[model samples]
Target chain A: MSKKSVPVVNIADRLAGFSELWSQKTVAVLNDYEVKLAKLRGEFVWHSHEDTDELFLVLSGRLTIQLRDGDVVLAPGELFVVPRGVEHCPLADEETAILLFEPAGTMNTGDAGGPLTKAAELVS
Target chain B: MSKKSVPVVNIADRLAGFSELWSQKTVAVLNDYEVKLAKLRGEFVWHSHEDTDELFLVLSGRLTIQLRDGDVVLAPGELFVVPRGVEHCPLADEETAILLFEPAGTMNTGDAGGPLTKAAELVS
Candidate 1:
């Protein structure tokens, strides 16, 4: 495979370009790479992907990944990876911003039904 | 493969646990997953891995990934990936902290022989 270059993106630069909450906007793509931004509030739907793990990195505010066993709270500069086939939901008290990295074709809301299942195109 | 649980580690907790600089310490492992910490200063040796690409996420201060063409500067809460077979090095003005995610056998200084090519065992 030929070497494909992935552009260097700054979170502050991307955050400055958009402001709406809970809307994940793509910043760059590297082969199967998918990076997105979303401002989350209240609770998200519990969902799980049958394939591929999901990486969640908290950009600002607090984020909690609720699982069947327990919940992990992520503060600013913290990260958590929700493994494949694990049922999880994310919640935030106020407006919380986050960056998500996953393989292409991974859903934001997993298999659960939710109003926030965004089918956003990858933005270059 | 049975589901192997990997402990969720907080960066602040890990940073507080260790004070020595430039030493990359392992916190958790998920199958082949390896997470490390390093306090960088000055310029690093330019090298490249023949295998997996490397992920760099800046924790504090500034980090510059020197490429053959140009360098990418990463501030706090920013991330960049150095593709496999691409020569690169990390430089810091003062003492800067960073978190790295790569496969188990990925080298910190790549193939370049350096004093910081630590063979330290992964801490549990």
Candidate 2:
């Protein structure tokens, strides 16, 4: 593909353009992985990816990844990686923007099935 | 490992604490990939990853990825990925902080092998 075929994405601009809580939009693809952005608020269900690790980077506001053992709190510009098979729940006290890096086909909700589970949609 | 075992990384904080141009420091590991931070200024040797695609997210300042066909310019909060085997060189007129995601063993210099070639080191 030509260079023009690849789109340039501004994380903040894209996040500001969308306002859906817990919905992830794939902004770019790098080989087998996808770069995603989402708005998060409240609490998500407990879940774990048995085979793939999940990466979370806070773009704005704050986020807390609650685990059975403890919580990993992330402020703006902070990031954390939840190892594979480790169950956890993510929460944000306020509306927060986040970036995620993970293998393609990796479910956002992982093994848990719930109302919040949705496949990621590609964003231009 | 416990939640405490995994270090929480603030991208801006880590980038601020270090001051080495073109050197990448691995901050976190997620599955088969490594999350890295780096400071870029001036120009880097043209190279390509034969096996793994490279992801670059600009945290501050601006960056230009010079490709054989065209250039991809990224501003703060923007990102671009150079597909595997695509020769490219990255440049930044001013000091720039960036986040990188790629397979653990991928080299920064790729097949071009030059003075800038170096292995990524793990950071706390």
Q: Which ten residues in a row have the lowest lDDT in candidate 2 chain A?
A: A1-10
Query: Comparing to the true complex, what docking class would candidate 2 get?
Result: medium
TM-score of 1: 0.81
| Error at B14, model 1, angstroms | 1.3
In angstroms, the error of model 2 at B88 is 0.5
lDDT of 2 by residue, B1-124 (tens): 2446558887777887889898889999988899999999999999889998899989889998999988898888888888899999999999988889999988889998889888998988
lDDT (10s digit) by residue, model 1, range B28-102:
553355667777888888988877677787888998888887788888877787888889878899778887767
Query: Candidate 1's residue-wise lDDT over A1-124, tens digit each?
Result: 2222546667787777777766778765433556678788888888998876777778889988888777888888677788889998888997788877776667787788578787646654
Q: For model 2, how does the per-residue alpha-carbon lDDT over A80-122 read when each residue is reduced to its tens digit?
A: 8888999999999998889999998888899997888899999
**Which candidate leads the pack in DockQ?**
2
What DockQ does predicted model 2 obtain? Answer: 0.57
Backbone clashes for every candidate come to 1, 0
Candidate achieving the largest lDDT: 2
Q: List the residue pairs that clash in candidate 1.
A: A22-A39
Tell me candidate 2's TM-score on chain B.
Answer: 0.94
